[model samples]
Target chain A: MMTFLVRRLAIILPTLVFVSFIIFGLQQLLPGDPALAMAGEERDPDAIAHIRKTLRLDEPIAMRYAYWMAGVVQGDLGISLRIQKPVGELVLQKLPVTLQLAAMAMLVALLIGIPMGMLSAVKNGSAWDYGANVIALWGLSTPNFWLGIMMILLFSVELGWLPASGYVPPAEGLGANLAAMVMPAFVLGNAIAAVMMRHTRSAMLQVLSSDYVRTARAKGLYERAVIGKHAWRNASIPVITLGALEFGQLLSGAVLTEQVFSIPGFGKLIVDAVFNRDYAVVQGVVLCTASAYILLNFLADIAYMLVNPRLRS
Target chain B: MTALLEVEDLRTSFKVESGRFQAVDGIDLRLEAGRTLGVVGESGCGKSVTALSIMGLVASPPGEVAAAKIRFEGRDLLALSADAMRDLRGDRLAMIFQEPMTSLNPAFTVGDQIAEAIQRHRGLDRAAAWARAVEMLRRVHIPAAEARAHDYPHKLSGGMRQRVMIAMALALDPKLLIADEPTTALDVTVQAQILDLLRRLRAESGMAILIITHDLGVIAELADDVTVMYAGKVVERAPVEALFEAPQHPYTIGLLGSIPRLEREQARLDAIEGVVPNPLSPPAGCRFHPRCPFAEARCREAEPGLGPVGPSHFAACWRTPLP
Candidate 1:
């Protein structure tokens, strides 16, 4: 078990390195030059030159990558040319917002998904199963942007129940923060919930039909115990993998939902950085997101060992 | 002298796209207390279904079980409520299945699984159940029972896993143990060891065993009485010695002849003429008539009922008292 953990942990470093390398290399290939983009409206040669030298844009691509990598290693994500602030500070400021949103979205997904999936599998071909499938399909197909707008129109504009746009940090009062973030979180989570529901349903269906499940029932275990314990434990292995990947997706890819709700999160931060040719902010955010993906996968492997005893060997 | 299990006209059918097919077609059985009864047939002869039906483990919806009476130790099992049935299962009546590798949950340690059964039925607390699980493992001759109890199902060999299954089934000391093809998935040597284990366990506990297997050798090994089923219907019922000695049914004779023996020097081993007829489209009348060498017009026109052929023996064939 220790070896498995160590091996999984070891792979994270090289993977992050590769991701960082790719992000840095790919940033150079974009159509517009960051030095020119940072030179302001005048298009002055002195300003462009100054910007190039200052940001090491004048250096060779490989040497510049090495510099950026060095800074990354030391937890210095470099300075955002547009904002004149450290990329790390901006990322740190935004991290909590996106993290909270992602966590809530994942919670919603799990809470709605797993039980629905379990019920769908248990009452397969019944009305409950059909109802879950229909809801899942609706969730999967509905655009987050449209759903976000519709929710704002109904809840914020008409009913006057919630603020349609912007974020309120948790320090401002927990209820207000939740009220503000809830719509955007749901918009992001609904799609993932659909995916989780399908994965959980299929996994549970396979488990419920397994020989061990039959063995479980033959032991005279109650239907609840049989499904909840014996069957659910096995079914959850695959769902955990899906959940980790999905949560990583939620963290990195809430751009549209964030835009619709005007939430200042990684989505807007990273998207704005890409458009403005803000290399430092873009590289830093992608690196952080990539790290999150790796860490989540590592956590997933540990979870597998916890649930499935065979992997401990 | 009384029967521990009395199954009468027990029919279990499955509803497929084509139509409903009876897997266990109104079979009757009576197993005396402490005796090992072997139900033997080719694959798809409904032996496993019968076991499942008796244990009340048959999956519903696609499958349904109906019977005149399934009495176990003076109680009609079919009449019991779902709750009552659950209390009896894994406690008073337990079962072990064919694929030991898959029978035990892969997620749990073998000991945890055994202890769970003990905890459920015996009402022992976790620690006491764990101790009992260790003891059960030791009884099944699992080496290093204390340490092995912590090991998962995947860690154990097929034979070892079968032992674990046996331990779990017998953990509650149930009155009846329905081992459905328990050794079918083991090596030849391992099969013998498991059979020996079962025989010894039965002797020790004196619990009636209903073993379902396709292997005649398995029947000869552990069975006190033997039931030969073909196409989901009993063709012959007799004491182990009598069935082997003076087999009346042609299918029984064919079964006996089919066994390859070193002493009987023959160029070819005898095999029954055809596969067990498909349950969906079984031949009219006697289910085995198509495969029977001595099949006649009368045999093809009407199904034979199980009746006495000798003292304490029965055969279900028109020409059963064969000259």
Candidate 2:
């Protein structure tokens, strides 16, 4: 297990480097000039040149990439051209909110998706199963942004039950933070829950029909025990993999949700940085999100080994 | 002495898209204490279904099991509530299946699987159940029982996994052990060893055994009384020696002939003429008429009931004696 983890970490290093290079390359290809964006409609070419020189935008693309790469390795994300502040410090301030939102979204997805999936499998072909399938289909088809808008209109505007937008740190108090997060989390989680539900249901159906499950039933175990102990554990392997992938997606894919909710998260920060031609912030956020995706996939492999004894050796 | 399990007029059917399909049609079986009753048949002949019916393991809605009477230990098993039947299972009645590789749960240790049965029926705590699991493994002649008990099913060979299954079935000291093609998936040597283990266990425990198999050689080796089935119905039944010696039904004779004999000078082993009929649409009269060599017009016009031919021997056929 130790060796496995070490090998995974080794692979992650090259992947992160490649991802950072891509982020830097893509930023250079953007149409707008960072210096001009910073100068903000100034008629004088002198002000633009001064801003470009100060921001090192006058250097060759390869040279600028090398400089940014060196800074990234040393834990310096450089300074935002628009805000004139350290990109690392700016991201760090908003990182917790994104993390909290993603975590909450994942929690909601799992808590509802797994049981509903199991129920659909156990009672396959029944009305309850059909109902779950229909609900999952709707969730999958509906875009998160549109869902977020509807939820805001219903819960915040119509019912006046929750705040329409913005975020509150948990340090301020758990209740207020949860209240502010509910709609965005639900919107983001619904799509993932739909995907997970389908995966889990199919996995469980396959496992439930397995010979071992029959043996479990023939052993005189209660129906619940047969499903829970034998079927569910085996089925969870695929579901866990799906869950980790969805979590990685949730971390980076919350751009629209964060916008609709007006939450100060990394996704929103990155989008804002892109429009302002803040090259450092975009590169930093992309690198972090890509690294998170790799880490999650590695963790998922370990989880598979844990869940299935057949894979351990 | 009374029989350990007496199943009379047992019938099991399934609901298919077309209509109801009878898998086991009007079967009668009796197993006495300390005796071994071997049920021999081809695939799809209801051997496994009979065992599942007796164990109440048959799924409902799509499948239904009905009987005139299914009495075990002087109580009607068919009349018992689901919970009552559950209590009896793994305690008074236990079963082992064909494929050891698929039957044992792969995620759990062999010890844990056996211990689960012990804990469920015997109410043993975890530690005590583990100890009993090791003992059960030892009883099944698995080498290094203590260490092997902790190994998962995937780590064990097919034979060892079957032995572990046997240990699990016998962990609660069940009064009746139903083995469904227990050695079908095993190698020849492993099959012999498993049969020998079962024989020894029965002699030691005095538990009645109902062994299901398609191999007549296994039936000849382990069975005291034998029941031969064709399609979904029992074609012949008798004491092991009588059934082999004076087998009346043509189907039974075909089954016995299909077995390759070392003493015979035949160039090729004989096979039953046709495949077992599909249960969804079996022959109108006799299920085996299509495959029987001696089948006559009357054989295809009407089904025959099991009738006495000799002492402790019964055969189902239109004509009792060959012309």
Candidate 3:
């Protein structure tokens, strides 16, 4: 396992280098000069030139890239041009909220989607199955932004059940933070749950037809045992993959969701940086999200090994 | 001796886009206490379907027990509710499937899968049930029973997994055990061992077994009574000895001839010609007419009903004129 981890990490090195090159190139190509944006239009040319030289803007792009790469190797993520703060500090400040939202959304998806999918598979062709399919279809088809608007309207504006926008740290109190985060989480979660439930249903249907399931039934197992114990566990292999992909997507997929909920998560921070042309902040966030996607996929592979003993080979 | 299981006019079919396909057409079979009744037929011949319908494990969608009366110890099996059927399965009756490799759940420990039925039907607690599972495993001659119980299905060899299947089926000492090609997937030596174990278990438990297979050797070795199925219907049935000595139906004779016998010297074993007819559009008269060497004009026009040919031998063939 350690060897496998080492091998994966080795592969990730070149990928990170490639990603940094793209982020550096794309920021360089943006319309407005950071020197002008930083110093303002009225600043003296000499003063602006001095700031550009200090920021290494006057240096060759290759030289600038080498310097940035060296700093990255030394655990320095560079400074945010707009905020004039360390990019790492800005990322650390916003990382927790995005992680919490993603975790909550995934938890909600698993709790709701797994059972719903099992029900659809178990009661197959019945009204409950039909209902679950319709719900899944709606969840998959409806845009997250539209769903977020409806949630805000129903839960916040109309029912006064939750605050319409903004975030509260869990340190403030568990209930308050949950209430603040839930609407955004719901918007993202419903969409993920739809995908997960469909996967679970299809996987379970396949497992249910296996000869072992027939043997289980021949042993006179109750329908619940036949499904929950036998079919569900076998079906979980695919569901686990879906869940991990959805989790990775959450950090980015929640960008619009975060905007609608007015939560200042990493997703929202990245969106803000893009519009304000904050190169350092955008690079840091992109790097972090990409790393997360790779790491979660690795974890999914491990989870697959854990669930299916046959894969130990 | 009183019969333990009697199935009469049993029919099962599946609904497809084309039409209804009758899998097990009208067939009658009986099993006396402590005896084996082997129903022999090739794949798609409805032998397994009959076994599943008997256990009420038939997948409902696209499949149904179209028509039948199945009786177990004078009680009507079909008349029972689903809940009641559940009670009967694994308690009074149990079934072992073909493909032992796939018959046991890959996710579950072999011991837990077996213990589940024991606890559910016998009302044993977890500890006692587990102990019984190990004991049953030992009975089936699986090596290192106590330790091996903790292992999953994939961890075991094909033969050992088959032993576990038999152990699970026999956990409750069911009155009637339906073994549907239990040894089909095993190697020849392993097959012999399993067949030997089954014969011994039958003797010890005095349980009536309905063994489904297309292997004449298996039927000859294990079955006291034999039923030959052709295209969803019973073509012939008689005591194993009598049927082999003098097969009344042409299909049975063809089947018996197809097997290479150690006792008989021949230039070449007789082969049954042609394939089984599609069930949806079976032959107008005798379903076996297309394949039967003795096919005649009447054989293709009118379906021959099963009737007694000898004292206990029954056949469905018009070629053999009625007495």
Cα error, residue B243 of model 2, in Å, equals: 1.2
Residue-level lDDT for A307 in candidate 2:
81
- The whole-model lDDT of each prediction reads 0.91, 0.89, 0.88
> Residue A134 deviation, candidate 1, in Å?
1.0
Runs of candidate 3 exceeding 4 Å displacement = A1-32, A60-63, A73-75, B66-68, B263-265, B321-323
Provide the DockQ value for model 2: 0.75
Question: Which lDDT tens digits does candidate 3 get at residues B233-274?
Answer: 998889999998989998888888888878889999888888
Model 1 lDDT per residue over A1-313, tens place: 8998998888888888889889988887888988888777899999888887887778898899899888888999999978989999999999999999999999889988899999999999899999999999999999999999999999999999999898999998999999998888888888889999999999999999999999888888889989999999999999999999999998885999999999999999999999998888999999999988888899899999999887888
What's the best-to-worst order under TM-score?
A: 1, 2, 3
Candidate 2 residue pairs in clash (backbone atoms < 3 Å): none
Highest-TM-score candidate: 1
TM-score of each: 0.97, 0.97, 0.94
What's the residue-level lDDT of B254 in candidate 1? Answer: 93
User: Residues A271-306, candidate 3, lDDT per residue (tens digit)?
Assistant: 878878787788778888888888888888888777
Candidate 1, after superposition: displacement of residue B203 in Å?
Answer: 1.3
Residues B1-323 of candidate 2: C-alpha lDDT, one tens digit per residue: 89899999999999888999999998999999889999999999999999999999888867899999999999999889998998898889999999999999888899999998888887889999999999999999999999999898999999999999999999888899999999999999999999999999998999999999999999988999999987789999999999888889898888889888889899988888878898888897778889878888988889888888988888888888533
- Residue B59 miss distance in model 3 (angstroms): 1.5
